[model samples]
Target chain A: MNKSIGFLGPKGTFSHEAVEGYRSGQNKAYELKEYHSIKDVLCALKDGEVDEAIVPIENSLEGAVNVTLDVLAKEEDMFIVDEFIIPVNLNLVAKQGTKAEDIKVLMSHPQPLGQCRNYLNTNFPGVVQLEENSTSKAAQKVVDGDGTCAAITSKIAAKIYGLEVLETNIQDNENNHTRFVIIARSLKAKTGADKTSIVFSTDNKPGSLYRVLDIFSLWDINMTRIESRPSKSALGQYIFFVDIDGHIEDPDVHDALTMVKRKTSFYKFLGSYPAFAGKI
Target chain B: MNKSIGFLGPKGTFSHEAVEGYRSGQNKAYELKEYHSIKDVLCALKDGEVDEAIVPIENSLEGAVNVTLDVLAKEEDMFIVDEFIIPVNLNLVAKQGTKAEDIKVLMSHPQPLGQCRNYLNTNFPGVVQLEENSTSKAAQKVVDGDGTCAAITSKIAAKIYGLEVLETNIQDNENNHTRFVIIARSLKAKTGADKTSIVFSTDNKPGSLYRVLDIFSLWDINMTRIESRPSKSALGQYIFFVDIDGHIEDPDVHDALTMVKRKTSFYKFLGSYPAFAGKI
Candidate 1:
């Protein structure tokens, strides 16, 4: 029996696209399931409802997805097995025969709406904007609603929902992209060009984080991204999420993480996975 | 002559509370104006619609309020004139005759809705939750709608909107607090106990950020907080928002930031204002 994979979806979401991308690279056919929320998608995998789960971790335009990072940090027995990057191409999509001028209400997940802020302000100023859980759900709303509604969503979502694309590349930034990760019960083997992600909180001291970063620098490791999320216990406390080049299998990477684990008050190694080298 | 202050408001939101707190500490009376969004509030200040604007900068539970930070970073001539911290006390409010059991739908701004997730999960289970622009707006919605509606809003909002408190302190964390900042056209004079906030983007190279952080460490400057936001240019590129303990008038802080500016590709000096030391 093939393993089942879970994604955040009502179908036609970017997470659904990531699932399709993952499937294309795999040798064996796998079952796919859609969970409504990112937390639900990860929890389903942990609960054995699925063997793998894919969810977005970061966007070029929107820094870190805090809920995803928070869930990954809090949950035990979860590891990233792969990584994927997808360019966010937002389109003004509506029902067939609906003109752009007729769009009185625009809808999307808050992200795409924000990504298209300039476009929306320029093209549809004063239009009522609504938020949905997913861009695909927004597309679904456009399909179900009266002719005055449109959604800023992926092309796949428009096609899947049988909506017409009224405008294309509606995002404010051409470089907009989202990075997604595949989470599993265990980590994957080293793929040479891989990245390791970890979350750790330091003692409430001035130079504590710098000391931790010094360890990576001393080991000649390259950090690709760094983000800080509030620890939720208090105002100033934070957990640092960092992605660095090299997998745990690398000798330097192994040594540096061992040092990092010992130095930090709290630490969690999220995973080591092959880095996505596609157009980001 | 009295100055005018602006805030993101519908008359009874937490921003309204922040404005009240600020007014209490002032020596002069000021005219208060309300803007619909964070950007609008800040832009109003920049556009000379108000002499100052108060906006939430960070929450103990939710971390940084990105819109406020992004707007401050992008706009010119905006400076932090003051800072205020208020404990976020969320209440479940409804019409006077409505009971907790009568609520079929709940409403609040997305932030408060998220802050009360566990509480809602335990109490309401699957109540239909709606999002409004502000908590006060949510309270107003409860007032205009049928009796079977409730809002998670501040105590002031419940009173102003003439709603009954069904439950008090519905937030998940007791430590929930939001920090608001007063932005003006000019910076405040240095107070001995002050914090300078700056946003800078380092070259996308290994050890580049570590070196910039090294400046603070070298000057013995204490950094209170550090957060990364996307540069909005590309993936893996980030602009860092840092709050350090000391005003620009402090020699060490001045020297460290001067070094930081010289080292970074892009830099912006947000402001230096007296640190809020009342409570965490």
Candidate 2:
């Protein structure tokens, strides 16, 4: 039976591309499904409408995608079972024969517009920018609208929407990449090279967080990343999302988290899964 | 002589309101100027065009404003001198005589749209949502266009744009607030009740960040908040922004920072300023 994988999409988004790339890596058959929003994808996973959901967790340029982080924090049923990194190469796509200079209005989702800020400022100095609901919608609008409009979207979108790429890698930074996480209802069996993600909030004390970090240090487990999101209960209170470079099934990791868990009022084990590095 | 303050605006933005609130608190007469973007506001400060720039640093619901954090990280000449907390009360403002049931579309900046998601979803499930460049722009568009549209903006914006407040405090969370920071070319003289903000990065070795936090614990300094933004140099690399309770001139804070400065590859003392607490 083919497994069902859900991702944020209108068929040509970066999330859709990441899902396709993940499907190819598994060497297993899967039925691809797309949701209109990040929340929709997670809700689909929770409601069993899909077996798994792949969503962008962080971007090198944009930092964390808050909606995904907040949803993962709130939805106790979902677990991150895998990770993928895709180099974000934004392209300036337009209808065929449309010259870059002739483009009076540029369009994209707010994020791409930001990532490509330097490029846009330098090239299209006085061009009007219009925000679309999604990058795919931006690409669609360029094709459906007049010749004097262009979109900053994916090359995949250019192909899917039958548009021509007027420019490639239009993003300001070459290192721009997005980290996507594969979420599922169950934890995967530990692969030797894996990472674990956990969310917890420390007690309202000065040294509470330092004490937690001390446990990781004592166990010699390397923490890959740490991000603080508001607890929403009050100002200055935060829930920390920590990624460590070992599976929970590992004895050292288990010992570290056990002690760390004891120190926090809220502790959630978000699962250990194979970690992906390098560009797609 | 009148001092000048810069803020993000098309006029009637939350940033504009924040500047007004800050001015009243200071009990001083100053000329207020509006800029097109956060960068413009900072640039105005750096160029000596404005005495100071006040911009939103973070939101209770939406994490850190990356552009503001990144700008602070990159611009060594600018410093955060003070902070203001403003409760974000999003209002559904429309042209006069527009009925809630007759509204076919809602408009706002993406941030407010997300903040008001639950309210929008429940009340106008089928209504079309539009994104404007700013919340103030959304209000202006509603007044300039058809009556069957509304905007999620501040009451100040509705009043300024000559729109009617169809619904008040329409945001999903009552506790939603934005933390705005006053940025200037020089740090403020330390107040007794003050907070210090600093940004730093540790060596890539394991336990490096833990060691830095250990120093804070050793000094008994209370860390009010901590945030990690990608250094933009590489994947998995991060620059940490930390807020601690105490003026930098405080002996304990100075001692801790002195030791911290020695340990990090990069350290920036953002500034010491009187911290604001309680609601505006």
Candidate 3:
């Protein structure tokens, strides 16, 4: 489908990198739009400015990307259609001619900041820490300044801004990975390696939740992740985010999820998408 | 309580701030202890080096604090008791004589990097950004560097480091809050306004979770927060972390939670503690 995918930020952000994952010749044949923030991207999708949008849902290191989840929970019309697990290679990018020793500050998004800690402390010893919209924004700041400044961003950001890469793959852990989801106006195509996401609330009885989980066990479908967000109604109330292996079109998946819908006080289907986690 | 609390670092870290809220001075007296790293603090608590530990579970602006949560979820026997919400104020603290412009580098915990985005971009602009364990550790780094640098930290951290505050409450959103839970060697003594936390997994089926939620709705009892961590067992399984209003000792609350225990494949109570959120 030719969908204009909207994502958060300018040229060098990770979301931009993730959007790149979806753009095979098939997807790039369509238009692409970029926004400066998650809210803007969501708004663009809601306003019908884009056929679909990509927003980060979580990171292995950081956990839930709450912004997208919170909005999707409230935006009744939207649903996730596809997802990508991008292996993040955060770099320490700096303006041309800035020596590593000359750098006194390190700037990047907060998640990258934590992901790159061991290198910074051991190398710079005591440099200033700063924040930016995304790693690419940090690269832009360094490009604009052209001083001892440097930024931790994706290699793509460095290439985008014509900056030199001071360090490659500087994340504290080499296994850094981020998961992004593609959201659409409604459910569409399904890939078999697909995973279905749903939100449901269990009644507060002892065996109620156990009984709910039993359905999947009985059907023999696999659940990958399960998370809960506050129902925001009152104390003692919560809604859960769950992931199961297999597409909704698959009989077992559909049968199990349908059964859950009947018992839950609250329920919503997020989507069924192939788990496209590319290797680093 | 007479329990000694272990946090991430020596002084003025987010854990220290969380301690302020989690500590009720109930059992005996709560003593604050500092560690150089999160692992150390948790290991200490697990080893009986400390009575209880205060750890950050999630950040509202940035999302889940994975490092802490992952460890808590993986480690058995230990569980969450109660949680408190604390506002994260990232301040630019420098030596008494240093001016904002004179500040060459900024330092802070990696997490706060995003929280102070607009301020860092506008004021320090292109200055180097560095990351440390927490705002407190960042302050110590700046202090060690003499007048050459400044750190972004809690005001309390500034006092601990004997640094003057260059900027106050430098966070992106005024509503930025962090929810921290107290994990102890065993269950805790009850404080007024107590909240109960539990973990459970339901059979994977339709309406399984719904039946569980119905327990509380029927009781008119309120739940505060609910989160699910992958059971990371046997595959296709999950266990949820749920916090609810009223002490476990309260009849309705006890009844509701007790019934929920039977509905899932697994269930564990984190704890109950006084809701220490004092003033907004």
Candidate 4:
């Protein structure tokens, strides 16, 4: 039997697009499964229902997808095996015979609505904006609702729902993109160009986090990103998430992470994966 | 003439409660105004429509409130003059005659829905969950709908909407709290116990952020929190938000900030304000 992969989907979402892109780039064909939510996809992978799972980690316009980050940090044995970046191109989609001027209500997932804030404010200032669980769901709602309803969703979603594309590229920033990561129960073999992601919490003292960063600095490792999330233990306490260049197999990267593990009160090695190489 | 304050409100949301707490602690009574959104409240402060505005900056369980951070980063002349922390107490409320078992649909803002995830899953596994703009809005929706609808909202919202409490303290985490910041045109006077928040972007090079944090380490200042948001210009580029102990009036903080401004390509001084004193 071919290996199976899980993704958050109803067939027309960004995660589905990412899975298609991932499949096109791979040598072997894999069985694909669609889960309802990010957590369901990840949990399916953890429970051995699928060989791998793909979920979005961050978006240029919206910042980190907190649920993805939270799950990765909280779950054990979940490792990132690959990454892909997809440009987010939002469109005003509606039922057949509907024009842009006919849109009395706009609907989408909150993130897309926010990304297209400027466009919506200028084009349909008084239209009611509603939130759906996903962009695809928004498109589905438009299909089921009156012709006056429109959805801000991907081109694929509009196509799948047989909706007219009233307008395209409606996001405020043309450079908008989302980064998705493929996760599995075990680590992937390190490619020459790879990134290691980790989450850790330092002691409640002056310069504790600075010292952890100092290890990366001292080892001359280049960190691509850093973010902090509340630890949930208290208001002031936080857990730091950092992504650095180089694979764990590299001597310096290995040494730096080993030191980081020793220095922090809590540590979790998320994964070492081949970094997304394409430009936004 | 009395000064006026602005908040994101329908009179029963958490921001409304924060403003009420702030007003009671103030020396003089201020006229209160309710805005439909966080951005509107902050923009009103910048445009001189209100003397001050209060908005939630971070939550213990859900993490940083991105809209508040984005507005503070994008807008000029907004300063943090005060801070308040509110314990999040989620309740299941419905019409007077509604019973707990009668709730066919659960409604709330996304944050509250997330905070009460475990509670809802265990108690109302098959119930439909809906999202509203605010917890108060969810309460209002329940009142406007059939008795089978229930809202996961604050006590204030239940009282204002004249709903009966089906259950109380439904959030998974008892320690969940949200931190709200009061923004004004100018900085507040330095209290001995204070915090200065600043946002900056470091050069896209190895150890650039480390060197900036090194200054805080060198000055013996404690950083209470640090978070990064995408620059939106490109992937892997970020701007950081940091809160540190001490007022900007202190020699160490002033010198550290001056150096930070000189080191980074972009810098913004959010403000110096007395830190919230109460324990969570």
Candidate 5:
């Protein structure tokens, strides 16, 4: 069967890169669909228009992507079947023959601009920063605009828009990477080495989350990630999205999740997939 | 003394509203200055250009503003001396005499647009969405553009920019509120009912964060908030930012914090402030 994957895209985004990387890794033929927003990507998955949706969930520099986490928490049917991490390599790109000194306006999405702040501050100094809807849009802007503009975007973005890379890997952090997750209607068959993701709201008591984490400690499961997002009910209320290093089929993992469900007011099984080791 | 406050602004943003609310609540005259971003707000505070800075730190729907959290985590001298929760009432505004039916383009900062997603999807259908640098900038865009353009922004922004309100409180969630924090160089004198905010990164051992929270449980301190941000050193490493229901002057809070500081590999004192109850 031909699998289909949906991603938040404009042909040359990091999301596109993630899907491409995943597709090549599997060496399988698949159809790729692009959506403008993370919400749309999830909606397509829920509607079964695609077999799986790959969306960014976390960045080393930017932390958790709230839209993805919130959607996962709210959407009961969707499950994360796998995860991917892509090293973000932001390039300063512009139209061909645009001199570096002539560029007065820097453009990109907020995150990439933020990640490259130090580079911008030191290099551009007082250049006017114009934020576009996306990095690809920024690259498109550079293509459309006069020689005074440059965009900090992906190499793929430059290739798509036929822009010239003035500088490569311009992000301040050399170790910057973004974590993406593959979401589907059902979980993949658990391998021995797997990671389980879940979201749960603790009982409204002091140290409720601490007590929940105690269960994982008792089971000796290593947690890979823990993020607390607002439950949207009140100011301090939070639903925890956690990824633990064990498959649901494992007895220890199953027991730990069962204990967590018993202790919390809300419990959601987000799914188990092969554990993502540092690279894609 | 002429006290001054810096905020993220283009004259009429929520940051401007926050400063206004803080100023009127104090009933003291203070010079107000506006900056383009939270980083600038913090820099002004750090450089003593402003007596303090008031920037949105968290939103009920949007979660913690990562820019604010990361800055609070990174900047050593700055402390969160106060907190304010403003109920976010996003309004659909346009030029005078412009009707809702005539509106074709909707502009605003991404967060406000996200908060009002349901309202926008239902009312506007497929209206072209525009992203501006700030909500106030969105209002300015509507003012600068044709009558068909409308902006999703604050009531204050509408008033400041002379845009007529087409609809008020357009946010999908009535409980939508943004939590703003006042940053200063030194802590305010601790009140009896106060909260202390601290950031700590645990040792990379198994169940590390759980063990740190256990100390808070042992002290019987009621924690008001807890968040984990990327330590920025690596992908999996995280720095836990915690707010507990007590003043650092209190013995229990002091002891718990002392233990937390001892347990963690890196620890930073964010500051102690009066506990925020609903309104500022």
Candidate 6:
């Protein structure tokens, strides 16, 4: 594998924070590659410009990131090889001397707005609002502020751009965690916390969904998450994405997948990688 | 039954559009009412405040509106009656003198971002962004801009505040459709194109999911959408909320539900409402 890995960014993003966490986890050698979009990063991987990409898969609060799921449903080769969670904390930042009281407009991404709806509705009652591309972009606007503006962003953003933090931990939920999945064209070294992700389309009959589950049950393999996304081909057919404990090599897990393959019209192993500890 | 209408605001919102849509479709004499939150609206119906409420279920470009699903999964004695696909045209509104060139910030709800992702990505590449509670709230901020700021909102919003339309049809997908459902505490007065929604939890055993589906097949019912949310109970168990063609009262749909009931540990009929009709 290459030493460099691409991450989603224009910098100072939670995606960037996830990249930071991944890099810090690697106590060995590596260089960081960054791209402004998930597609761009995924493309770079396709071109062999990078070894892998870290894509945000889900948030505890928002459920699955459908964009990643949609893209994954099509790409046949990429496997989700590792997973990580990043605790997000955003601040209201602005150009130096833009005091909280003087702030006339506040901006952030839509997800952050909903996450911090409680803060904005209560503390900043009747305050003028705005939306930006990414929280980091919001941070950039704070620097370019003609005054009268503030941004909901990470503290790292404020420090990186010389802005001041007006508020802290502004999201509505205290236990906010976003799950990120590391994807590559091939498998990783397989750590002990391993879990296999697979996608399949089953026949539209009674006990069809149950019959697939029977494999996991009989094998005593536990599933962590199961998501249903439209197959996009026909109206009624669907693709089920499930993550389960154990590796592809494990006899019980292999047997379950083989059994499911026999019963379902279609099935594919998405990846086998270490799962995050205890967020389920 | 009396109407228990719902809009997403303390008093004003685009949900009001869906409410008006429902009003126009039903007999003109049917009474209409409102609520502050979607959950509150569902509660009003469950606790018997009103018969049915209008709620936004999904958006064409944005996919599912997760909040509606989250609330519906838990609420008792309710199902979608009729679905309206409301065509949306977002206009960038500004205070009278604010020029498109002078506007430094743009604001709206997250819905608009994905709606107009391409437009913003191309034309407004570096503009400052902000997300608010609703397009109405964003309109309010632009009205109070007190600076060079604008909000992407509805034409009605511009009319309500006497603002200028700086931009129009700004959504990424020109055919932006928001599907709003008329929900009630009991089965609706069947309008012909009825669809039934139900949630069920089967034993967490292999073949359990498949067996449940065999019931749907036995009756030859068409399932349009199937989604899974966390059981939020013990781990490894999942509750599937399914939408299928035919009202529960129909012979085949009736037989399907009856057989499904026997196989699942639990089942609940959310409601039998008119099938969702995409924008006409």
Instruction: Find the candidate with the highest lDDT and give its number.
Output: 4
List where candidate 4 sits over 4 angstroms from the true fold: A99-104, A124-127, B99-104, B124-128
Worst 10 residues of 2 chain B by lDDT: B125-134
Per-candidate TM-score against the hidden true structure: 0.96, 0.96, 0.66, 0.97, 0.95, 0.73
Worst 10 residues of 4 chain B by lDDT: B125-134
What is the C-alpha DockQ of each candidate? 0.69, 0.63, 0.16, 0.69, 0.60, 0.26
Q: Residue A195 in model 5: shift from native, Å?
A: 0.5
Give the per-residue lDDT of model 6 (tens digit) for B18-38. 677767766754556666456
Candidate 2's residue-wise lDDT over B199-263, tens digit each? Answer: 99998889899999999999999988999998877778899999999998899999999999999
Give one digit per residue, the lDDT tens place, for model 4 in A49-79.
9999999999998899888999999999999
Q: Which 10-residue span in candidate 6 chain B carries the lowest summed lDDT? A: B229-238
Error of 6 at B273 (Å): 2.6
- The per-model lDDT (C-alpha) reads 0.88, 0.88, 0.74, 0.89, 0.87, 0.74
- How are the candidates ranked when ordered by TM-score, highest leading? 4, 2, 1, 5, 6, 3
Please list the residue runs of candidate 5 whose C-alpha ends up more than 4 Å from where it truly belongs after superposition.
A100-105, A121-133, A146-148, A278-280, B99-105, B124-130, B277-280
Clashing pairs in 4: none
Better of 4 and 6 by DockQ: 4
lDDT for A51 (candidate 1): 90
Per-residue lDDT of B1-280 in model 5, one digit per residue for the tens?
A: 8789999889889888878887878767989999877788898999989999999988998788887888888887899999887878889999999988898888888788878877887898767676665899888878889899999888988898898998899998888988899999998998888989999999888888888888988999887788888888888889888888888889889898999989999999999998676552
Interface RMSD computed for candidate 2 is what?
1.7
Q: Which model is ahead, 3 or 4, in terms of lDDT?
A: 4
Error of 2 at B78 (Å): 0.6
lDDT of 6 by residue, A86-162 (tens): 87776778887777677787877555665676687677766766655567877787777788888888888788878
After TM-score superposition, the amount by which residue A206's alpha carbon in candidate 1 deviates from its true location, in angstroms, is: 1.5
